[model samples]
Target: MKSKNTMFLVQAATIGAIYVVLTLLFAPLSYGEVQVRFSEALTILPYFTPAAIPGLFVGCILSNLLGGAIPVDIIFGSIATLIGAVFTYKLRGSSKWLAPLPPIVANTVIVPFVLYYGYGVNLPIPLMMLTVGAGEVISCGIFGMIVLTALSKVKGSVFGKASYSK
Candidate 1:
Protein backbone atom coordinates (compact mmCIF):
# COMPACT_ATOMS: atom_id res chain seq x y z
CA MET A 1 0.00 0.00 0.00
CA LYS A 2 2.76 2.40 0.91
CA SER A 3 4.64 1.53 -2.21
CA LYS A 4 1.60 2.15 -4.36
CA ASN A 5 1.15 5.60 -2.91
CA THR A 6 4.84 6.34 -3.36
CA MET A 7 4.72 5.27 -6.97
CA PHE A 8 1.74 7.48 -7.62
CA LEU A 9 3.50 10.49 -6.10
CA VAL A 10 6.62 9.81 -8.05
CA GLN A 11 4.76 9.55 -11.31
CA ALA A 12 2.87 12.78 -10.71
CA ALA A 13 6.04 14.65 -9.76
CA THR A 14 7.86 13.31 -12.77
CA ILE A 15 5.05 14.35 -15.10
CA GLY A 16 4.91 17.83 -13.61
CA ALA A 17 8.67 18.29 -13.87
CA ILE A 18 8.68 17.10 -17.46
CA TYR A 19 5.87 19.51 -18.29
CA VAL A 20 7.82 22.40 -16.81
CA VAL A 21 10.95 21.44 -18.66
CA LEU A 22 9.16 21.07 -21.98
CA THR A 23 7.39 24.36 -21.61
CA LEU A 24 10.57 26.20 -20.66
CA LEU A 25 12.57 24.53 -23.36
CA PHE A 26 10.00 25.61 -25.94
CA ALA A 27 9.19 28.83 -24.17
CA PRO A 28 8.54 30.82 -27.31
CA LEU A 29 6.12 28.31 -28.79
CA SER A 30 4.60 27.32 -25.46
CA TYR A 31 2.58 30.47 -24.88
CA GLY A 32 0.60 33.20 -26.66
CA GLU A 33 -2.04 33.31 -29.41
CA VAL A 34 -0.27 31.18 -31.95
CA GLN A 35 1.34 28.61 -29.70
CA VAL A 36 1.69 24.90 -29.20
CA ARG A 37 2.98 23.83 -25.83
CA PHE A 38 4.44 20.44 -26.64
CA SER A 39 3.99 19.46 -23.01
CA GLU A 40 0.27 19.39 -23.69
CA ALA A 41 0.79 16.04 -25.36
CA LEU A 42 1.01 14.63 -21.87
CA THR A 43 -2.54 15.70 -21.17
CA ILE A 44 -3.54 12.24 -22.25
CA LEU A 45 -1.77 10.73 -19.26
CA PRO A 46 -4.89 11.15 -17.17
CA TYR A 47 -6.45 8.42 -19.28
CA PHE A 48 -3.94 6.04 -17.73
CA THR A 49 -3.94 7.28 -14.12
CA PRO A 50 -5.78 9.74 -11.92
CA ALA A 51 -2.43 11.11 -10.75
CA ALA A 52 -2.13 13.08 -13.97
CA ILE A 53 -4.93 15.44 -12.96
CA PRO A 54 -2.94 17.30 -10.34
CA GLY A 55 0.27 16.68 -12.18
CA LEU A 56 -0.97 18.62 -15.20
CA PHE A 57 -2.45 21.39 -13.05
CA VAL A 58 0.71 21.95 -11.05
CA GLY A 59 2.79 21.72 -14.18
CA CYS A 60 0.77 24.37 -15.98
CA ILE A 61 0.95 26.66 -12.98
CA LEU A 62 4.68 26.30 -12.64
CA SER A 63 5.22 26.67 -16.35
CA ASN A 64 3.14 29.82 -16.53
CA LEU A 65 4.79 31.30 -13.46
CA LEU A 66 8.36 30.59 -14.49
CA GLY A 67 7.62 31.61 -18.04
CA GLY A 68 6.60 35.08 -16.75
CA ALA A 69 2.89 34.85 -17.38
CA ILE A 70 0.57 37.44 -15.91
CA PRO A 71 -1.40 36.67 -12.74
CA VAL A 72 -4.57 36.03 -14.69
CA ASP A 73 -2.84 33.48 -16.89
CA ILE A 74 -1.24 31.80 -13.88
CA ILE A 75 -4.63 31.41 -12.21
CA PHE A 76 -7.03 30.80 -15.09
CA GLY A 77 -4.58 28.80 -17.18
CA SER A 78 -3.98 26.44 -14.30
CA ILE A 79 -7.70 26.21 -13.77
CA ALA A 80 -8.15 25.31 -17.42
CA THR A 81 -5.56 22.57 -17.16
CA LEU A 82 -7.16 21.23 -13.98
CA ILE A 83 -10.56 21.15 -15.59
CA GLY A 84 -9.17 19.44 -18.67
CA ALA A 85 -7.28 16.78 -16.74
CA VAL A 86 -10.22 15.94 -14.49
CA PHE A 87 -12.48 15.59 -17.47
CA THR A 88 -9.95 13.53 -19.32
CA TYR A 89 -9.66 11.12 -16.40
CA LYS A 90 -13.42 10.96 -16.05
CA LEU A 91 -13.95 10.37 -19.76
CA ARG A 92 -11.18 7.84 -20.14
CA GLY A 93 -13.56 4.91 -20.17
CA SER A 94 -15.50 6.38 -23.05
CA SER A 95 -13.00 6.13 -25.89
CA LYS A 96 -9.35 6.62 -26.63
CA TRP A 97 -10.11 9.30 -29.18
CA LEU A 98 -12.21 11.24 -26.70
CA ALA A 99 -9.48 11.54 -24.08
CA PRO A 100 -8.04 14.76 -25.45
CA LEU A 101 -11.30 16.57 -25.99
CA PRO A 102 -11.67 17.94 -22.50
CA PRO A 103 -8.34 19.69 -22.42
CA ILE A 104 -8.84 21.03 -25.90
CA VAL A 105 -12.29 22.33 -25.07
CA ALA A 106 -11.22 23.76 -21.74
CA ASN A 107 -8.35 25.66 -23.24
CA THR A 108 -10.37 26.75 -26.25
CA VAL A 109 -13.17 28.13 -24.11
CA ILE A 110 -11.00 29.73 -21.43
CA VAL A 111 -7.83 30.95 -23.11
CA PRO A 112 -9.43 33.52 -25.36
CA PHE A 113 -10.74 35.40 -22.37
CA VAL A 114 -7.34 35.38 -20.79
CA LEU A 115 -5.71 36.71 -23.90
CA TYR A 116 -8.25 39.46 -24.47
CA TYR A 117 -9.06 40.72 -20.99
CA GLY A 118 -6.09 39.45 -19.04
CA TYR A 119 -3.38 40.26 -21.51
CA GLY A 120 -5.16 43.13 -23.23
CA VAL A 121 -4.74 41.56 -26.64
CA ASN A 122 -6.51 43.26 -29.53
CA LEU A 123 -7.76 40.18 -31.33
CA PRO A 124 -11.47 39.41 -31.46
CA ILE A 125 -12.72 36.76 -29.06
CA PRO A 126 -13.84 34.49 -31.86
CA LEU A 127 -10.50 34.79 -33.59
CA MET A 128 -8.64 34.20 -30.38
CA MET A 129 -10.75 31.14 -29.81
CA LEU A 130 -9.94 29.90 -33.28
CA THR A 131 -6.24 30.37 -32.73
CA VAL A 132 -6.24 28.81 -29.29
CA GLY A 133 -8.39 25.96 -30.50
CA ALA A 134 -6.09 25.36 -33.41
CA GLY A 135 -3.11 25.23 -31.11
CA GLU A 136 -4.90 22.83 -28.78
CA VAL A 137 -5.78 20.66 -31.75
CA ILE A 138 -2.12 20.50 -32.61
CA SER A 139 -0.86 19.93 -29.09
CA CYS A 140 -3.63 18.03 -27.36
CA GLY A 141 -5.37 16.47 -30.32
CA ILE A 142 -2.49 15.54 -32.60
CA PHE A 143 0.46 15.21 -30.24
CA GLY A 144 -1.70 13.87 -27.45
CA MET A 145 -2.96 11.12 -29.70
CA ILE A 146 0.59 10.29 -30.61
CA VAL A 147 1.54 10.01 -26.96
CA LEU A 148 -1.49 7.88 -26.24
CA THR A 149 -0.56 5.52 -29.04
CA ALA A 150 3.00 5.17 -27.82
CA LEU A 151 1.95 4.70 -24.21
CA SER A 152 -0.63 2.09 -25.12
CA LYS A 153 2.00 0.06 -26.91
CA VAL A 154 4.12 -0.14 -23.74
CA LYS A 155 1.52 0.05 -20.99
CA GLY A 156 2.25 -3.40 -19.66
CA SER A 157 5.97 -2.90 -19.62
CA VAL A 158 5.97 0.68 -18.33
CA PHE A 159 2.86 1.20 -16.21
CA GLY A 160 1.97 -2.39 -15.35
CA LYS A 161 -1.13 -4.46 -16.02
CA ALA A 162 -3.22 -2.31 -13.68
CA SER A 163 -3.15 0.49 -16.21
CA TYR A 164 -4.34 -1.83 -18.95
CA SER A 165 -7.84 -2.20 -17.52
CA LYS A 166 -9.06 0.49 -19.86
Candidate 2:
Protein backbone atom coordinates (compact mmCIF):
# COMPACT_ATOMS: atom_id res chain seq x y z
CA MET A 1 0.00 0.00 0.00
CA LYS A 2 1.02 3.60 -0.57
CA SER A 3 2.28 5.68 2.31
CA LYS A 4 -0.82 7.87 2.31
CA ASN A 5 -3.12 4.87 2.47
CA THR A 6 -1.05 3.29 5.20
CA MET A 7 -1.11 6.51 7.18
CA PHE A 8 -4.87 6.80 6.77
CA LEU A 9 -5.43 3.24 8.00
CA VAL A 10 -3.15 3.82 10.96
CA GLN A 11 -4.94 6.99 11.90
CA ALA A 12 -8.35 5.35 11.67
CA ALA A 13 -7.25 2.32 13.68
CA THR A 14 -5.76 4.52 16.36
CA ILE A 15 -8.96 6.50 16.65
CA GLY A 16 -11.00 3.30 16.90
CA ALA A 17 -8.74 1.99 19.65
CA ILE A 18 -9.03 5.23 21.58
CA TYR A 19 -12.79 5.12 21.29
CA VAL A 20 -12.89 1.60 22.73
CA VAL A 21 -10.68 2.65 25.62
CA LEU A 22 -12.79 5.66 26.51
CA THR A 23 -16.05 3.74 26.33
CA LEU A 24 -14.70 0.91 28.44
CA LEU A 25 -13.11 3.29 30.91
CA PHE A 26 -16.49 4.92 31.44
CA ALA A 27 -18.41 1.69 31.26
CA PRO A 28 -21.22 2.74 33.53
CA LEU A 29 -22.05 5.87 31.58
CA SER A 30 -21.19 4.45 28.18
CA TYR A 31 -24.26 2.23 27.77
CA GLY A 32 -28.00 2.05 28.51
CA GLU A 33 -30.85 4.41 27.72
CA VAL A 34 -29.19 7.31 29.47
CA GLN A 35 -25.57 7.25 28.45
CA VAL A 36 -22.92 9.92 28.39
CA ARG A 37 -20.28 8.23 26.34
CA PHE A 38 -17.09 10.19 26.62
CA SER A 39 -15.98 8.54 23.42
CA GLU A 40 -18.66 10.46 21.57
CA ALA A 41 -16.47 13.51 21.97
CA LEU A 42 -14.09 12.02 19.46
CA THR A 43 -16.85 12.25 16.86
CA ILE A 44 -15.73 15.82 16.33
CA LEU A 45 -12.50 14.55 14.81
CA PRO A 46 -14.09 14.17 11.39
CA TYR A 47 -13.93 17.92 11.11
CA PHE A 48 -10.16 17.65 11.14
CA THR A 49 -9.49 14.52 9.11
CA PRO A 50 -11.49 12.23 6.84
CA ALA A 51 -9.87 9.26 8.49
CA ALA A 52 -11.96 10.11 11.53
CA ILE A 53 -15.10 9.17 9.66
CA PRO A 54 -14.28 5.49 9.48
CA GLY A 55 -12.41 5.71 12.75
CA LEU A 56 -15.43 6.86 14.73
CA PHE A 57 -17.70 4.29 13.08
CA VAL A 58 -15.45 1.32 13.72
CA GLY A 59 -14.67 2.65 17.13
CA CYS A 60 -18.31 2.78 18.10
CA ILE A 61 -18.77 -0.72 16.75
CA LEU A 62 -15.99 -2.22 18.83
CA SER A 63 -17.03 -0.20 21.82
CA ASN A 64 -20.57 -1.48 21.68
CA LEU A 65 -19.44 -5.00 20.94
CA LEU A 66 -17.00 -5.14 23.81
CA GLY A 67 -19.41 -3.28 26.03
CA GLY A 68 -21.80 -6.23 25.61
CA ALA A 69 -24.35 -4.26 23.69
CA ILE A 70 -27.20 -6.16 22.08
CA PRO A 71 -27.16 -6.83 18.36
CA VAL A 72 -29.51 -4.00 17.46
CA ASP A 73 -27.60 -1.47 19.51
CA ILE A 74 -24.34 -2.56 18.02
CA ILE A 75 -25.52 -2.13 14.46
CA PHE A 76 -27.76 0.92 14.80
CA GLY A 77 -25.53 2.71 17.23
CA SER A 78 -22.56 2.42 14.91
CA ILE A 79 -24.68 3.59 12.03
CA ALA A 80 -25.58 6.70 13.96
CA THR A 81 -21.92 7.40 14.56
CA LEU A 82 -21.12 6.75 10.91
CA ILE A 83 -23.85 9.08 9.73
CA GLY A 84 -22.72 11.76 12.15
CA ALA A 85 -19.11 11.39 11.13
CA VAL A 86 -19.96 11.71 7.44
CA PHE A 87 -21.97 14.83 8.04
CA THR A 88 -19.27 16.21 10.28
CA TYR A 89 -16.74 15.65 7.53
CA LYS A 90 -19.02 17.38 5.08
CA LEU A 91 -19.22 20.32 7.45
CA ARG A 92 -15.48 20.45 7.96
CA GLY A 93 -15.16 23.86 6.31
CA SER A 94 -18.20 25.19 8.13
CA SER A 95 -18.39 26.53 11.67
CA LYS A 96 -16.57 24.44 14.23
CA TRP A 97 -19.51 24.68 16.61
CA LEU A 98 -21.61 22.75 14.14
CA ALA A 99 -19.14 19.88 14.10
CA PRO A 100 -20.60 18.27 17.19
CA LEU A 101 -24.20 18.86 16.27
CA PRO A 102 -24.43 16.00 13.82
CA PRO A 103 -23.48 13.29 16.28
CA ILE A 104 -25.62 14.84 18.97
CA VAL A 105 -28.64 14.89 16.73
CA ALA A 106 -27.96 11.51 15.23
CA ASN A 107 -27.55 9.78 18.54
CA THR A 108 -30.43 11.62 20.14
CA VAL A 109 -32.74 10.56 17.38
CA ILE A 110 -31.56 7.05 16.72
CA VAL A 111 -30.47 5.79 20.11
CA PRO A 112 -33.87 6.07 21.74
CA PHE A 113 -35.27 3.55 19.32
CA VAL A 114 -32.36 1.27 19.97
CA LEU A 115 -33.02 1.55 23.68
CA TYR A 116 -36.70 0.88 23.37
CA TYR A 117 -36.59 -2.00 20.94
CA GLY A 118 -33.16 -3.42 21.59
CA TYR A 119 -32.88 -3.17 25.35
CA GLY A 120 -36.61 -3.09 26.05
CA VAL A 121 -36.18 0.10 27.99
CA ASN A 122 -39.56 1.30 29.17
CA LEU A 123 -39.53 5.02 28.52
CA PRO A 124 -41.32 7.42 26.27
CA ILE A 125 -39.40 8.05 23.08
CA PRO A 126 -39.48 11.78 23.65
CA LEU A 127 -38.21 11.36 27.16
CA MET A 128 -35.47 9.08 26.00
CA MET A 129 -34.63 11.59 23.33
CA LEU A 130 -34.35 14.25 25.96
CA THR A 131 -32.11 12.16 28.18
CA VAL A 132 -30.03 10.96 25.28
CA GLY A 133 -29.88 14.45 23.86
CA ALA A 134 -28.67 15.78 27.14
CA GLY A 135 -25.94 13.21 27.20
CA GLU A 136 -24.97 14.05 23.64
CA VAL A 137 -24.90 17.72 24.48
CA ILE A 138 -22.55 16.98 27.34
CA SER A 139 -20.45 14.51 25.43
CA CYS A 140 -20.61 15.74 21.85
CA GLY A 141 -21.28 19.42 22.39
CA ILE A 142 -19.34 20.38 25.51
CA PHE A 143 -16.68 17.71 25.70
CA GLY A 144 -16.33 17.49 21.94
CA MET A 145 -15.82 21.22 21.75
CA ILE A 146 -13.04 21.03 24.29
CA VAL A 147 -11.36 18.31 22.28
CA LEU A 148 -12.02 20.15 19.05
CA THR A 149 -10.46 23.33 20.30
CA ALA A 150 -7.37 21.53 21.55
CA LEU A 151 -7.05 19.54 18.32
CA SER A 152 -7.52 22.63 16.19
CA LYS A 153 -4.32 24.02 17.65
CA VAL A 154 -2.35 20.99 16.49
CA LYS A 155 -4.43 20.33 13.39
CA GLY A 156 -1.65 20.93 10.93
CA SER A 157 0.93 18.94 12.82
CA VAL A 158 -1.17 16.00 13.92
CA PHE A 159 -3.56 15.64 11.00
CA GLY A 160 -1.18 16.77 8.34
CA LYS A 161 1.45 14.32 7.03
CA ALA A 162 3.04 11.10 8.14
CA SER A 163 6.77 11.22 8.76
CA TYR A 164 7.14 7.84 7.01
CA SER A 165 10.20 7.08 9.08
CA LYS A 166 10.51 3.56 10.39
Candidate 3:
Protein backbone atom coordinates (compact mmCIF):
# COMPACT_ATOMS: atom_id res chain seq x y z
CA MET A 1 0.00 0.00 0.00
CA LYS A 2 2.75 2.43 0.91
CA SER A 3 4.68 1.57 -2.23
CA LYS A 4 1.59 2.03 -4.36
CA ASN A 5 0.94 5.47 -2.88
CA THR A 6 4.54 6.49 -3.42
CA MET A 7 4.45 5.26 -6.97
CA PHE A 8 1.29 7.28 -7.59
CA LEU A 9 2.91 10.42 -6.27
CA VAL A 10 5.97 9.85 -8.39
CA GLN A 11 3.87 9.37 -11.48
CA ALA A 12 1.87 12.52 -10.81
CA ALA A 13 4.98 14.57 -10.22
CA THR A 14 6.67 13.27 -13.32
CA ILE A 15 3.61 13.95 -15.40
CA GLY A 16 3.31 17.47 -14.03
CA ALA A 17 6.93 18.23 -14.74
CA ILE A 18 6.72 16.84 -18.24
CA TYR A 19 3.59 18.87 -18.91
CA VAL A 20 5.24 22.07 -17.74
CA VAL A 21 8.27 21.42 -19.90
CA LEU A 22 6.19 20.63 -22.94
CA THR A 23 3.96 23.68 -22.50
CA LEU A 24 7.05 25.85 -22.21
CA LEU A 25 8.49 24.22 -25.28
CA PHE A 26 5.50 25.44 -27.27
CA ALA A 27 4.78 28.52 -25.24
CA PRO A 28 4.20 30.73 -28.23
CA LEU A 29 1.78 28.40 -29.98
CA SER A 30 0.10 26.87 -26.93
CA TYR A 31 -1.46 30.08 -25.71
CA GLY A 32 -4.00 32.49 -27.29
CA GLU A 33 -6.75 31.48 -29.75
CA VAL A 34 -5.24 28.42 -31.41
CA GLN A 35 -3.43 25.94 -29.17
CA VAL A 36 -1.41 22.93 -30.21
CA ARG A 37 -0.17 21.35 -27.06
CA PHE A 38 1.82 18.37 -28.22
CA SER A 39 2.18 17.32 -24.61
CA GLU A 40 -1.57 16.70 -24.47
CA ALA A 41 -0.76 13.35 -26.02
CA LEU A 42 0.05 12.24 -22.50
CA THR A 43 -3.63 12.62 -21.67
CA ILE A 44 -4.21 9.18 -23.19
CA LEU A 45 -1.98 7.59 -20.58
CA PRO A 46 -4.97 7.67 -18.25
CA TYR A 47 -6.43 4.83 -20.30
CA PHE A 48 -3.59 2.65 -19.08
CA THR A 49 -2.91 4.12 -15.62
CA PRO A 50 -5.25 5.65 -13.09
CA ALA A 51 -2.35 7.75 -11.89
CA ALA A 52 -2.93 9.83 -14.97
CA ILE A 53 -6.03 11.40 -13.42
CA PRO A 54 -4.34 13.62 -10.85
CA GLY A 55 -1.25 13.54 -12.99
CA LEU A 56 -3.02 15.29 -15.83
CA PHE A 57 -4.88 17.65 -13.52
CA VAL A 58 -1.78 18.80 -11.73
CA GLY A 59 0.00 18.99 -15.03
CA CYS A 60 -2.64 21.27 -16.50
CA ILE A 61 -2.72 23.45 -13.44
CA LEU A 62 1.02 23.86 -13.40
CA SER A 63 1.22 24.41 -17.11
CA ASN A 64 -1.48 27.06 -17.01
CA LEU A 65 0.27 28.85 -14.20
CA LEU A 66 3.52 28.84 -16.09
CA GLY A 67 1.85 29.84 -19.32
CA GLY A 68 0.27 32.92 -17.69
CA ALA A 69 -3.27 31.96 -18.57
CA ILE A 70 -6.10 34.08 -17.19
CA PRO A 71 -7.45 32.97 -13.82
CA VAL A 72 -10.69 31.69 -15.31
CA ASP A 73 -8.86 29.74 -17.94
CA ILE A 74 -6.47 28.32 -15.38
CA ILE A 75 -9.35 27.05 -13.27
CA PHE A 76 -11.81 25.90 -15.92
CA GLY A 77 -9.17 24.76 -18.36
CA SER A 78 -7.65 22.55 -15.73
CA ILE A 79 -11.09 21.27 -14.90
CA ALA A 80 -11.65 20.33 -18.51
CA THR A 81 -8.47 18.29 -18.65
CA LEU A 82 -9.19 16.75 -15.26
CA ILE A 83 -12.64 15.70 -16.32
CA GLY A 84 -11.32 14.24 -19.55
CA ALA A 85 -8.50 12.41 -17.82
CA VAL A 86 -10.87 10.89 -15.29
CA PHE A 87 -13.23 9.79 -18.06
CA THR A 88 -10.37 8.27 -19.95
CA TYR A 89 -9.12 6.45 -16.86
CA LYS A 90 -12.57 5.03 -16.22
CA LEU A 91 -12.81 3.85 -19.80
CA ARG A 92 -9.52 2.07 -19.70
CA GLY A 93 -9.23 -1.23 -21.58
CA SER A 94 -12.11 -0.30 -23.86
CA SER A 95 -10.18 0.34 -27.06
CA LYS A 96 -6.85 1.91 -27.79
CA TRP A 97 -8.37 4.04 -30.52
CA LEU A 98 -10.93 5.45 -28.14
CA ALA A 99 -8.47 6.32 -25.39
CA PRO A 100 -7.58 9.75 -26.79
CA LEU A 101 -11.06 10.81 -27.74
CA PRO A 102 -12.23 12.09 -24.37
CA PRO A 103 -9.49 14.69 -24.08
CA ILE A 104 -9.97 15.73 -27.67
CA VAL A 105 -13.69 16.10 -27.20
CA ALA A 106 -13.45 17.73 -23.81
CA ASN A 107 -10.94 20.33 -24.89
CA THR A 108 -12.75 20.92 -28.15
CA VAL A 109 -16.03 21.53 -26.39
CA ILE A 110 -14.73 23.67 -23.54
CA VAL A 111 -11.86 25.55 -25.17
CA PRO A 112 -13.87 27.22 -27.90
CA PHE A 113 -16.04 28.88 -25.32
CA VAL A 114 -12.98 29.99 -23.49
CA LEU A 115 -11.45 31.45 -26.61
CA TYR A 116 -14.58 33.33 -27.44
CA TYR A 117 -15.40 34.67 -23.98
CA GLY A 118 -11.99 34.79 -22.40
CA TYR A 119 -9.83 35.86 -25.31
CA GLY A 120 -12.61 37.82 -26.97
CA VAL A 121 -12.12 36.00 -30.24
CA ASN A 122 -14.91 36.87 -32.68
CA LEU A 123 -14.57 33.73 -34.78
CA PRO A 124 -17.67 31.69 -35.53
CA ILE A 125 -18.43 28.60 -33.47
CA PRO A 126 -17.73 26.30 -36.37
CA LEU A 127 -14.38 27.89 -37.01
CA MET A 128 -13.42 27.62 -33.34
CA MET A 129 -14.44 24.00 -33.35
CA LEU A 130 -12.47 23.31 -36.47
CA THR A 131 -9.29 24.91 -35.18
CA VAL A 132 -9.49 23.49 -31.66
CA GLY A 133 -10.61 20.06 -32.86
CA ALA A 134 -7.88 19.96 -35.42
CA GLY A 135 -5.22 20.71 -32.84
CA GLU A 136 -6.59 18.05 -30.48
CA VAL A 137 -6.88 15.48 -33.28
CA ILE A 138 -3.29 16.09 -34.20
CA SER A 139 -1.94 16.42 -30.69
CA CYS A 140 -4.04 14.08 -28.58
CA GLY A 141 -5.06 11.72 -31.37
CA ILE A 142 -2.10 11.35 -33.66
CA PHE A 143 0.71 11.92 -31.20
CA GLY A 144 -1.20 10.22 -28.42
CA MET A 145 -1.66 7.14 -30.59
CA ILE A 146 2.07 7.00 -31.12
CA VAL A 147 2.70 7.24 -27.41
CA LEU A 148 0.08 4.59 -26.77
CA THR A 149 1.71 2.25 -29.22
CA ALA A 150 5.13 2.80 -27.73
CA LEU A 151 3.86 2.33 -24.20
CA SER A 152 2.11 -0.88 -25.21
CA LYS A 153 5.44 -2.42 -26.05
CA VAL A 154 6.85 -1.73 -22.57
CA LYS A 155 3.68 -1.84 -20.51
CA GLY A 156 4.99 -4.43 -18.17
CA SER A 157 8.34 -2.78 -17.71
CA VAL A 158 6.96 0.72 -17.01
CA PHE A 159 3.52 0.38 -15.38
CA GLY A 160 3.24 -3.38 -14.76
CA LYS A 161 0.45 -5.72 -15.82
CA ALA A 162 -1.76 -4.79 -12.87
CA SER A 163 -1.63 -1.14 -13.90
CA TYR A 164 -2.97 -1.97 -17.34
CA SER A 165 -5.83 -4.14 -16.08
CA LYS A 166 -9.29 -2.68 -16.25
* Inter-residue clash pairs, candidate 3: none
Ranked by lDDT, the better of candidates 1 and 2 is: 2
**lDDT (C-alpha, whole model) for all candidates:** 0.89, 0.90, 0.84
lDDT per residue for candidate 3 within 79-155, as digits (tens), equals 88997898888778677788888999898888888888887899987788889889889888999989988998788
lDDT of 3 at 69: 88
Against the true structure, whose TM-score is highest? 1
lDDT per residue (tens digit) for residues 83-154 in model 1: 999999888777799989999999999999999999999999999899999999999999999999899988
Worst 10-residue lDDT window, candidate 1: 157-166
Report the C-alpha lDDT of model 2 over 73-143, residue by residue, as the tens digit.
99999999999999988888778889999999999999999999888899999999999999999999999
Q: What TM-score would every model get versus the actual structure?
A: 0.96, 0.95, 0.94
1 or 3, greater by lDDT: 1
Off by over 4 Å in 3: 163-166
Point out where model 2 deviates above 4 Å. Answer: 161-166
